[model samples]
Target: MTFYTYGYLTTHHNTWQYARIGLLIALLVVFIGLFVHYLRNRWNVKYKDLSIITGVLLLLVLGLQINSLVSLQSATKQSGEISATVQQAAKHLKVSPSSLSINSTSVSDNLLIKSSQGYYRLDYNTDGSAFILEKVTLENPKIKLVKE
Candidate 1:
């Protein structure tokens, strides 16, 4: 992962998630501390039972958080791959990203990039699990603006 990917993950990519994670962490600490205080001040069977319940809840929340992180990581990885591919294509063609354009909507996830130098095709699986760049020839490429 590049620094750009990390930046997007922290800043641009579903910013609400990071905030939610932070809030959950704070609540977890506060509630756990409260439970510990109760247990320390007075020994009770009910408090111990509730503490066990809290432990189970903690595990569940952690599992869910891991699931959320996995989804976020996958989405970010895909976006990063696309961005890197476009940037690489631009560099290979000796042009800046602003001078480059790509079209992918009709290509089933693969990209057809256009630049003044030539054409470059970024081929990848439809599932976005992989991508590769290749020099291509297109007579009349109807590429729209997608210079990531």
Candidate 2:
């Protein structure tokens, strides 16, 4: 599914996220096992110390990954709101959202909407405090407005 935010559009990959987290967890478990083995064998103090440090670093990275996942979920919610608003606007212009070509940039809040019926744009202010309809250009024949 395509996710539209203030500045850009993103594609969701549900399976990839889960796979990445699972891989990290597996690596952490393997590291822990190795750490225990080194300590039990008393092979080298340096090896044991290195393993402990590596384990701590992995834990820190795992925490960061979880935090990022939470942030992404919130962003997805905001994207849904933006998408709904766009669909409503398209209905007002008598066109399906699917029929329009949407263009968004990562550096700007403006979204360009274009279709055979006309061209339009909307600007979503920072923090989503406001949504401004920047421009609307209807075709010369002017299609019949359809309310959905």
Candidate 3:
């Protein structure tokens, strides 16, 4: 998870945003109730001490909630960027590109490349150009493209 964060942004594993919120609210309610009970039952305990504890707990909870929200938002934004880049690559590869004979690369087994249109391998070396295509063999064996 940390490695992925360092490179590609992934969505938070917790898809249950509502559940997380509910759990946090429940914990806050329980903590407050317990603190109140402790204060009411313990005459020796100072109210000032309880107030301090409550303030600290509230701060901690708020910090946690904010962090979770920020992390979730960041993951979403990064994932969107990655997806957009992949789509752009696909679009460019589908555009007119020079094709050659079948290659030995693993990506060649499932796709066929043509100068104008064909299934394109995602791992082609495009040299940062608009797109690149490599020859691939399909199961049907009927795939054919004329070299331009």
> Is 2 or 3 the stronger prediction by lDDT?
2
Model 3 scores a TM of: 0.41
The residue-level lDDT of candidate 3 at 122 comes to 41
Candidates 2 and 3: which is better by TM-score? 2
Rate residue 75 of model 1 by lDDT.
75
Error of 1 at 22 (Å): 1.0
Q: Which of 1 and 2 is ahead in TM-score?
A: 2
Give me the candidate number with maximum lDDT.
2
Compute the lDDT for candidate 3. Answer: 0.47
Q: Tens-digit lDDT track for model 2 on 1-148?
A: 1223322333443566777687688768878887888878896787687778778878877887888799778767765665666666667677766665455323246565656665567777778655665567545633332221
How many pairs of residues collide in model 2?
Answer: 0
Clash-forming residue pairs, model 2? none
| Prediction 2 global C-alpha lDDT | 0.61
